[model samples]
Target: MSVEHDKALAAKGRHIALVIAATMLGWLAMSLFIGPALGLAGRYALLFDFAALAGFIYAAVNIFQLWRMRQDSQR
Candidate 1:
């Protein structure tokens, strides 16, 4: 592959990593503060917890994808 193509791939990977990290931080903040500050009751709070878990799972997947991209680029 050409230098420009490699550079573009690296740039894209960096952008994806930054966006995913920001999203994960937002979810972390929401789970830690916003969810409880709303004063949700038992079941509602449970639902919110599940939503937070989903967000974490999504972030994990994105992180794995980033790792895979880096590994492939090294090859």
Candidate 2:
């Protein structure tokens, strides 16, 4: 493979890693802070709901990636 190809692949990998890490951290931070604060704000606020929705989205994404990795491994 060409040097350019290698550099591109590395760059792509780095980007993906950064995104995944950030999402994971965001989920963690929200769960720890905004989630509970919203929950304590009585039954009208949507902070907890937002956290739940974000958790589901991130979980789905991570699961999809895992499934894809499994598929690739099977090949």
In model 2, the worst 10-residue window by lDDT is: 40-49
Question: Which pairs of residues collide in candidate 1?
Answer: none
* C-alpha TM-score for every candidate: 0.55, 0.51
Tens-place lDDT per residue, model 1, 35-56, is: 6788656576566557756766
Candidate 1 differs from the real structure by a C-alpha RMSD in angstroms, to one decimal, of: 3.5
> Over 4 Å off in model 2, which ranges?
38-75
Highest TM-score among the candidates is held by which one?
1
Backbone clashes per model, in order?
Answer: 0, 0
Q: Can you write out model 2's per-residue Cα lDDT over 1-75, one digit (the tens) per residue?
A: 457655755665565566666766776666667757666554423554566567667656766665565466556
Model 2 TM-score on a 0 to 1 scale: 0.51
